[model samples]
Target chain A: MENKILEIVNTVLENRGKKAIRKINPSMSLRNDLDMDSLDLAELTVRIEAEFDIDIFEDGIVNTVGEIYAKLNIK
Target chain B: MNVLITGVSKGLGLKLTEVLLNNGCTVYGISRSLSPELERLITEFGSNLKWLRYDLSDTNNLKTEVFKHWIGLGTPIHAFVNNAALAYDDVITNMNLDALENMYAVNVFSPLMMTKLVIRQMLLHKIKGSIVHISSISVHTGYKGLSMYASTKGALEAFSKNTAREWGALGIRSNCVVAGFMETEMSSTLSEDQKNRIYQRTSLKQQVDVESVANTISFLLSDESRSITGQNIHVDCGTI
Candidate 1:
């Protein structure tokens, strides 16, 4: 699940022509660490939803990879 | 082009569907009920015309029922026509809260939700999509007992402009077709005298042709209008 989330995050980053991160930590801030803006977050949400069938941003704003895992019940 | 259009059972929506289909574009049409005309079109077009019976009043199910289950994430929606709207015609004095909310739900809320999902779909597919919202000249001109209905259209026009501004960088265009009064079921309730008075306001002094409005929509959806976005293209007959 973490690897898949990393791939999705990297997909969004690479789409924006940004550097792809090799690893995603639980405490990594999506905006600060990944340099994702609101639109990028939206893209991330849709891509995540497409893959997991769960909308991470549906219930509330997700700030970290850990929060997304929690939304997907990946703990 | 795979275009998702709402209110495809009749009026401008039906005409637009036919026009798009004739232009060799696939249509995913949504209406509350299946009219015989739409059924016939479905039979004629086969896989080209996909019909989904959905009430726009239920904005909640848009993501689940319409987008996820029906259109699917894999299918790239090249364009979205937000045409379905509920007409809550009443003078301000006789305004009913419940009816107003219901109208807003269908006209404003549902379209807003649909636009969000459609943009998301476009983003996922990396498609430079177009979104056209069907507005009314009533929004521009004062109409008797049409204030509520016009308010909904006004909201759409505003939304479309902002959507264009926000998504223009991504090549997603948003626009509104501000159509004049047409001879359709929507205007069936108007008396002949009232209709004539409305028509007289336009320079053409005749009912706005539905075909013209439909064609305008098709143009907006196509690459022909690629440079046009964040605009209210008035298909009205010079309503001053």
Candidate 2:
């Protein structure tokens, strides 16, 4: 599951021509590493929710891959 | 003849700026950055165009920024084009909430807020002005992933008509231009075949370019279109 999370983040990063999500830490901010602003995060969350069929936008969680994984019990 | 166009740095906004300047209208091209292409036009237009570096998505202070820009112009604006927008394609059942929020903010709220501020400026200066909200065909046609994008534009057009009604007495004319899918950098993401399919749906079966749309907008601002207001003129190749 954690690997899946990494793959999703990497897909977005790849599409955006950014570095791979190399260092994964629970505390890592999506903006800092991903160079993603609010729009990217929003689209990422949308895609993640669709893929997993979960409701994350409700709580405003799933901000980062770590948060998403934690919420989805990926770790 | 100061004209404000949000997202004036690139794509249709850049083209509109050039077209307006060619018509001898001073344009205040508002965008986050001045593209080299815009710089070239500015150099040639020489005082007919000025670029404003401000992000419309920064909703917290968009109205203030717009007011500041109007003040800086030293002349009342003759027209405004709310041309900036953002799009993300996803199913409605699982649209990105954050993206949707920011999308509506930039596409709908920012333009609405800017219009209010511009009306205030016009009222203060006791000047007559025309405003055009550049809407999209997405407002009427349903697209698989364009729900959020289309909704915001629909909202803008709705608000524009109401504004035109409300401001008509104040010498402020507001109208929306429902533009068909144009051959723009924004559409460059699509394959040629994909673009061809989209163009086939238009009545003319051709993609409208920025110049065609800009000409209509320039007409709306000029006295030639003075009697028109609260109209969503379809520059959409006769598409419904």
TM-score, one value per model: 0.97, 0.73
DockQ for the candidates, in order = 0.89, 0.01
Q: Give the TM-score of candidate 2.
A: 0.73
Stretches of model 2 off by over 4 angstroms after superposition: A1-75
Which candidate number maximizes DockQ? 1
Q: Comparing to the true complex, what docking class would candidate 2 get?
A: incorrect
Top candidate by TM-score: 1
Model 2 per-residue lDDT at B207:
88
Worst 10 residues of 1 chain B by lDDT: B82-91
Chain B of model 1: TM-score?
0.99
lDDT of 2: 0.77
> Which docking category, incorrect, acceptable, medium or high, applies to candidate 1?
high
Candidate 1 local lDDT, A1-75, one digit each (tens): 899999999999999999999998988999999999998998999899889888888777889878888899987
How much lDDT does candidate 1 score? 0.94
Clashing pairs in 2: none
The Cα error of candidate 1 at residue B189, in Å, is 0.7
Query: Could you tell me which 10 consecutive residues in candidate 2 chain B have the lowest summed lDDT?
Result: B66-75
